[model samples]
Target: MVKTNAMRMLDKAKIEYTTREYEVDEQNLSGSHAADMMGADHGCVFKTLVLKGEKMGYLVCCIPVDGELDLKKVAKAAGDKKVEMIPMKDLQKITGYIRGGCSPIGMKKQFPTFIEESARSYSEIVVSGGLRGQQIALQPQSLIGFVKGRFASLMQD
Candidate 1:
């Protein structure tokens, strides 16, 4: 098993998660693309996004592969009047993970993290493993427990 900071964090928290690794394809590295590469259902895969809310400068937002993030709703959920997606250059500084490899767990700093309600419906959800070509699969509750993330309707219709 790769001992990434993410895995170490999960281990420290005693959160149960399984990691899978694949070859990095420079052409396709997004969550949806990774799901397709892994032959996993898109609904079961999630993407981690960082946003700057009106009140909150940096927050973690997790949405499913097929879902679109509603910036307005996310801002409201964060108790911010408005929200803007954080820039790629600022991602590592904020979350400690690169754009295509950010995960909800093991961030350099703990920020308010929110997961879409849809994630709770699945038995397991896949997320970036803190590195390209890797993903972690785990139960929603475990993820919530580890990250202490709030559940919200941050997804768009």
Candidate 2:
């Protein structure tokens, strides 16, 4: 298996993680599709999103494939009065990752990250491996610590 930047970062941090590779369907790079390919539950698969807050420059959010991020809650958790997703065209330049392949780990810069509190219920969760068709699985708490992130109510009720 080809190692991705995310995997290499984990290795360097001595962070235990497992990788799963699946065939790429560029037309359907949704998180749910990835979970289906890995034969895992949708809730255990997370997507990383980058947003810019009015008060903060940049922040990250990791939510379940099946969950939706409530922007108001995200803003509250981020201590910003408001927040909005960065334009897709600016994704790579800002985070060094493109949509469908962005990982909460190994971002170009360590933006303040927040993981859905629901993830704490699971032992391990899957995230993009910093590349399309590759995924990384690791403990939820481990991810939070590695990313120096906090657990918050980031999803809609």
Measured by TM-score, the strongest candidate is: 2
Worst 10 residues of 1 by lDDT: 21-30
Report the C-alpha lDDT of model 2 over 24-143, residue by residue, as the tens digit: 898998999988988998988999999999999899999999888899999999999999999999999999998899999998899999999989999999999999988999999999
TM-scores for the candidates: 0.95, 0.98
Which residue pairs collide in model 1, if any? Answer: none
**Root-mean-square deviation of every model:** 1.1, 0.7
Pairs in steric clash, model 2: none
- Model 1 C-alpha lDDT per residue in residues 1-157, reported as the tens digit of each score: 5678888888888888898777777877777888888899998899999888766778888999878899888988899898999878988877788878898888888889999988899999999989988799999888888888988999888
- Candidate 2 at 116: error in angstroms? 0.3
lDDT for model 2, please.
Answer: 0.93
lDDT of each: 0.86, 0.93
